[model samples]
Each structure stands twice: as C-alpha cells, then as structure tokens.
Target: MREFDYERAADAAHAVATVHADPDAVFLGAGTNLVDHLKLGITAPGRLVDVSRLPFDEVTERPDGTVRVGAAVRNADLAAHPLIRARYPMLSAALLAGASPQLRNLATTGGNLLQRTRCVYFQDPTVPCNKREPGSGCSAIGGFDREHAVLGASPECIATHPSDMAVAMAALGATVRVLGADGEREIPVVDLHRLPGTAPERDTVLHHGDLITAVDLPALGWATRSTYRKVRDRASYAFALVSVAAALDLDDGVVRDARIAFGGVAHKPWRAFAAEDALRGAAATEENFGAAADAELAAARPQRQNAFKIPLARAVLVATLRDLAGQEAR
Candidate 1:
C-alpha cells in the first residue's frame, strides 16, 4: 500500500551489510506478518531485502542426532517432514494448529519466531500502544484487556507474545544460529524473547542487522512422546487462550525429567521452571500433576477480565501433563 524499494539478497553477507547500512531496511522472509504489518502502517520499511531464496531452506539432522532447521524453511514443509513428524510430533501438532494450510505453506521458521503480537490495540494506529510507538502510553492497561497477559506483564504494557512454535521450541531447548554484522552467535530459545519490564517495546534480544540462519534443537528423548495442547473459543484458526507444550521422561512411574512451556499467557514462553523442578523425581500421579500446575500458576497476576487465564492455564497444564503420563484426564 505504501511506496517501497525491494531487492533479492545476493548472499548472507550482502544482506547483513545492506541492513546495517540502512536503518529503514527490513529482511523479508515469508512476508506473512511483515506484509500485513506494512499495510496496517504498523511498520514501514523503506527497503525490503528479500532473503527467502538465499539457499538456506534445508532441514538437516546432525551426527549427534540433533536437528537443524533452516531459517527460511516453510512451516508446512517442516511440519510434514517425516523426521520431524516422527521425532517431534508436538512441533508438528502446534504448527498444524496455527494459521490455515495456505499461510503455513508461506510462513518460515525465522519469521514465525519473529511474528508480532496479536494485541488489538497494537494493530490499530488510532490506539496508543507502547509496543508500536514508545512513549505513546499503552491503552490496553485499562481497556479491552481480556486477551492481555497475566504473567510477566508490566505496568507499562500487558500484551502477550503470540507464537505457538516458540513455546514448543522453548520446551525442546532449541538454539538459534544468528549471523549478524558482528559475526555468528547462538541464542537459547528461552532467552530469545524479552520480558516487558520497563521497556515493553523490545520484544526480542535480536540486534539490528542480525539474520537468523538456523534453529538447532538438541537431541531430546521425550520428543516423540511430547504433546502440545491448545485451548481456544473456536477450534479452527483461533489463537490459544492458554496452551501447554510438555515432554517428560519417567523411570518406573517416577518423573526423571520434565520440560514444560506455556503459550498465550506471558510476554515470552512460560517455561514453568518451578513446576518442572517439583515434578522431577516425583511420582507421575494426578496429585503431582496438580501440584506442578499450581506451582507454575502461583505467580500469575491477572487483571479483571484475564483472571480466568490462571485457572485456564492450570487446567490445561494438568490435563496435558496427564496426557504425557498416559493418565486419563478427570
């Protein structure tokens, strides 16, 4: 809708250099969310550096049994990959549970992680949003906050980070390989997103001119047995009210290890570290699951309309943990 220049990146170096040179430039991968943002006036990049055809679309498995997904790999292709479907069913499930098939066919791995929030105020230009325009003040604090955050929220803003893949990736302990103007660096998936403390505008730790090259997931034994459960008002094409991605390793009905990450509840993926600590070495029983869910939700500080999210998160976690434990939900 707006006038903009575009070019296909010749290589990674040229792309990074171009971005560094022009602060008004943005790398274009899938263009699903970025294009929409552009049309909505949420973002206006003077130049679009297309990197979708940069020869980084492969998904490879390493000798150590870990998997490395190219940044430009399509969500549909990645989800349908035989190795990913068989090894990381939870990821596939969460991917399929997201936007429609057509969108998934165009969405890329890096773009999905960089996707913006779905907060209504942030999308509308008339509404004052700190994320969209810093120092403009956040209108969601006292207005239409039913879908706002409950945990990891600040007085400045109460928006939630919307990414189903990021939640599953967090549980998998995935690492992102970034190639920036400063060279290469790996960022843990958990540390990728930032909390909305005083600065709610910065959603991630990514620096300017940094291009995410790939995502590396460590070899996890629970990948096959993992489950991702998302609850929403409507089943199809709906964002999660509270979603849970969980994987476990138990010995003789006793929990040996647990990985839990929550979506649609916080600024970043809620890992439930305290809950995992409580579940470790504990019996895989209904009582233990309840205790773990409670421990995780104990820190929840909900607003008027969003107070239900705490119970919703708890119920989802309990049922999801039971599903992972091969127990019937109550």
Candidate 2:
C-alpha cells in the first residue's frame, strides 16, 4: 500500500551488506510473508531486498548423514524431497500440514520459519499491537485471544509463532546457519528464537545484515519414526490450536530417547524438554506419556478463553506416542 524501494540481492555478501547498510531494508525470500505484511501495512520497510534469487534455494545431501536445506528452498520442494520423505518424515509431514498447495509452492524454508504471528489484533492495523509498533500496547491481552499463546507468553504480547516447519525443526534439533557481515556461524534452531520478554518486537536473534543461508539437520537415529499431529478448527488451511512434533527412541519396549516440540501454543516453537526428560528411561505407557505431557505443560500460563490448549496439547502428545507403540521405531 505504501511506496517502497526494491533491490535484488546480487550475492551473499551483498545480501548481508545491503541490509546492514540500510537499517530499513528487509531480505525477501519468497515474498509470501513479507508481501503479506506489506499489504497489511504492518511492516513498512524502506527497501525490499530480493534475496529469492540468491544461491541459497537448495537442498543438498551432506556427507555426514545430514541434510542441508537452503533458506530459499521452496516448502513444496522440501516436502517432496525423496530424502526428506524417507528419512525425515516428521519434517515433511509438518511442511505439508501448513497453508495451501499454492502458498506452499511459493513459500521458502527460511521464510516459513520467519513468518509472523496470526493474532487478530496483530494483523488488524486499527488495533494496538506491541509487536507491530513498540509501545503501542498489545490488544490481544484484553481483546479476542482465543488463538493466543498459553505458554511462555509475556505481558506485552501473547501471539504465537505460526510455523509447523519450525516446530518440527525445533524437535529435530536442526541447526540454523547464517552468514553475516561478521562472517558465518550457527545457532540451534530452538535457540535462534527467543521468548518475547519485553522486546515483543524482536522475533529472532538474527542480527542486522545476517542472512540465514540454510538449516542443517544432523542425523538423529529416531528421526524416521517421527510424526507431526496438528489440531485445528476445520483441518485444512487452518492454523494449529495445538500441534505436536515428536520422535522417539525405544529399546526393548522401554523409552531410550525422545524429542518433542509444540506449535501454536507459545511465542516460538515450544520444545518439551520437560516431557523428554520425564520419558527418557520410563516405559512407553499411556500413563507415562500423560505424566510427561503434564510436566511439560505444567508451567503454562493460560488466559480466560484459551485454557483448553493445555489439555489439547497434552492429548496430542499422548496420541502421537500411542501410535508409535510396539513399532520398530526406525
């Protein structure tokens, strides 16, 4: 709606340098999220740096039994990859469970992870949103909050990160690789995003001029046995009220390992470290799963309209674990 300058990023350094040089510049991947924000008037970047043409839209197999997904890799391509479908079914399932076919075809991997919240007030420019503008106040706190976060919410904002792919990546322990003016470095996907705290405006820890190149997933033995379950209102094209991405390693009917992350319930992907710890040496049982889910969600702070999310998240976790019972967990 507003007039803005556009620049096509020529190279990796240029992409990083461009944004760093211009504080008002944004690196565009697929224009799915950025364009939506621009149309909504939520974001008014002075310059749109088109990074979609950068050489980061690739999915390469690494020698260390890992898969490297370039930031610009389209969601559809990542979901349909033979390696992703076979070895990382959870990631593939999570990817396919999001948006629509047409949107997925244009949404890039990094863009998906960096997508903004879907909170009603945040999207509505007429309302106050601390995330959209500092000190504007959060309308969701006292307004329609049925779809807001229950866990890890802040006084400034209760919006949840809308990304199924990110939840799966957090569970899979994927490493986010970035290249900045300072050079290249890696951050765990889970750590890349932080609690809203007081800085509700800052969604991620990525510094200015830092470009997320790819996400590298190291081989975790139980990856293939993983699955993602999403509970939403109408099923298709709906955001998750609560979603679970889980992978388990069991030895002789006893739990050997587990990784669990939650979506649509927190400021970012909610990694159920408490649940994983509780399930580590416990026998795979309904009661054990229930207890683990409870432990992880025990600290959840709920508002008036969305307390149901805690139980819904617990039920999804219990069911996902049940489906894996007695199977040769990959």
CA lDDT of each prediction against the hidden true structure: 0.90, 0.91
Write down the TM-score for model 1. Answer: 0.98
Lowest lDDT 10-residue stretch of candidate 1: 217-226
- The top-ranked prediction according to lDDT is 2
Per-residue CA lDDT of model 2 for 1-330, tens digit only, reads 678898898898988998999999889888887888888888898898889988888888898888999998999999999989888889999999999999999999889988889898888999888998889899998778889999999999999999999999999999999999999999999998878899988999999878889999978867888999999999789999999999989888788999999999999999999999999999998889999999999999988899999899998899999787652223
lDDT of 1 by residue, 1-330 (tens): 779999999999999999988999999998999988988899988999999999779999999999999999999998899978888888888888888899999999999999888999999998899999888998998899888888999988899888888899998899999999999999999999998888888999998889999999888967788989999889878788899988889888999999999999998888889899999999999899989999888889998799999989988888888888898866
Best by TM-score: 1
Determine the C-alpha RMSD for candidate 1 after optimal superposition of all C-alphas. Answer: 0.9
lDDT of 1: 0.90
Clashing pairs in 1: none
Where is model 1 more than 4 Å wrong at Cα?
A: none
